[model samples]
Target: MLRIKGTIGDWPVDLSVEMDDADWARLAQNLPTVAVAPSAQVAAQPAAAGPADKLWLAAQDLLRRSGSVEGPELMDELEALAGSTGAAKGLLVRLRHSPKVKIEVRDGVQVFNWVEE
Candidate 1:
């Protein structure tokens, strides 16, 4: 038996326990659609955390200041807040009703901006 794992590209992932001969053939036979349920997949995704939820709520405060935000000016702030607080970008955008996020440069300072609905 062999264990296989590690990166295929920039993506970080893990694969384990390589099989041979008969075992490989058995797995190959089920490749089309093997023992998977849609509900199981939906359930497997973990629920979002509450603190992260709150942080995003706070980010929305910035959105209220303006319909959008400057990306470059706020990327560090946004990424830091989101990463440290475990907030999801999708959630942030959805909650704030601002999907158009962007960056710009002025007077050598990069600025971040977003459009709100």
Candidate 2:
């Protein structure tokens, strides 16, 4: 049996799952394993930009191009660009606190603007 309790935003989550021995055995059997060739294993892995890096760059570009953008509108655009609401929200929060960003409330809504140097 597995139990999980947590909160996502304002919502509470409580989940319980049970697995028998056979279930665990089947799951273990189906788990994936990587088989690297000896020659390939010796090769250096290429540096790749992670999702967060890409998202940060995209967010910076968006803010720079738009000058100032409404919070909801920015969130929508970010969600489309990042392909996930959670990622968009995380980026927005980071942007909100970034020293390079300027936040203001306009007509009861938050507006985010890139601070020009």
On lDDT, the candidate that comes out on top is: 2
The reply for model 1, stretches above 4 Å from the true place, is: 1-49, 66-68, 83-117
Per-residue lDDT of model 1, residues 36-99, tens digit only: 2224323444565233334444455554455445544354455554553223333333432334
Model 2 alpha-carbon miss at residue 81, Å:
0.9
Cα displacement (angstroms), candidate 2, residue 8, comes to 9.3
Each candidate structure's TM-score, on Cα atoms with residue i matched to residue i, is: 0.31, 0.58
Residue 67 accuracy (lDDT) in model 1: 49
Model 2, residue 38: what's the lDDT?
A: 23
User: Model 2, stretches more than 4 Å misplaced?
Assistant: 1-48
Return the TM-score for candidate 1, rounded to 2 decimals.
0.31
**lDDT tens digits, residue span 14-101, model 2:** 9876766565445333322222222321233333733344445556677877999999999998777656787676567667756779
- lDDT comparing candidate 2 with the true structure: 0.66
Candidate 1, lDDT over the whole model: 0.44
Candidate 1 residue 25 C-alpha distance from true site, Å: 40
How many residue pairs of model 1 clash at the backbone? 12
